[model samples]
Target: MTLEVMARCSAAAMAALAVMMAVGTDTVGQDTETVKPDERSKVSQYGIRWTFSEPRRVGRFVNGDWWVVGPATVVSVTPKPGPAPEDEVTEIKRNQFGDAAHQDDRRMRNGSMIVIKSSGRQGYDSRVKSYDPGLSVQFPRPLKPGQSLISSVSHTSLPNNNFSHKIMW
Candidate 1:
């Protein structure tokens, strides 16, 4: 065969080999398939309880599955006979977990705690206002003889299909 013809045939053979390698046919396992239900409930036995020493100004129990739009804070006090001091304020919100798709947990004073599991999203704006069993709080703190206290709990679901339950008293 002429040298040019021989070279052309060799090039064509190499091209076919490259195509075959790109479309690999190696099967690593059998074709058997099995599907399972997506069961995503985490809290099987969850509970929250709080105790106080005195009473002070109270607010409505804003209950819901809240998505954190910005930072949040919490305040707690032993409740003295006089007016509640401002020093009792406890900032809460620095203890969040995950990057754009991660989970985190946080604890706050005033008998409040939170578990944050988030898959980050830009301009995320979604919240729910309802009662859920996973987010329940029992206040045991004793108010003054005539004073009262307020407690609030919140629960939320993350973008990654995970749920969070928070309680404050």
Candidate 2:
């Protein structure tokens, strides 16, 4: 088509669209009621936020499960952490089978912990069921709204099946 004809057709189509949108808005807005900010429901508020730092690409497991760790802060509005709802917690207990030196049974809530959230396997040939894409350090202690603790993930399991009680910086 010619430039003039195309421009006219485009202009006519835009005009019609504007008219339809104006009519639709008028009809839809008539039945709507203005909602105040204070009147909104607060049930969805958890009062906790996680601020993650730049992730470092840590070494990958032999099974092709790549891992990354970074410092994180857990900001909470209230002293007591949000109520523990069963639906939010995924309990995965790793039982010690053999006579391993590391016998410490750790829980996430007991103290500061590192939570690894993954997006699943990145490669099809990976032996691991999921991939450890990223991890964040969390504090069990309460934190004020503007307060944050300096924490990061560390590997305790040492070389040759040894374990370190203290995590070196």
The alpha-carbon lDDT assigned to residue 21 of candidate 1 equals: 11
Location of the lowest summed lDDT over 10 successive residues in candidate 1: 11-20
* Candidate 2 TM-score, true structure as reference: 0.20
Each candidate structure's TM-score, on Cα atoms with residue i matched to residue i, is: 0.16, 0.20
Q: Residues 47-141, candidate 1, lDDT per residue (tens digit)?
A: 32222232222211133211111111212222111212334332222225522321232222112212122212111111211112232222332
* Tens-place lDDT digits, model 2, residues 137-163: 233333323222222121222121212
Give the number of the best model, judged by TM-score. 2
lDDT of 1: 0.21
- Can you tell me which runs of candidate 1 are displaced by over 4 Å? 1-103, 108-139, 158-169
What is the number of residue pairs that collide in model 1? Answer: 4
Q: Count the backbone clashes (under 3 Å) in each candidate.
A: 4, 0
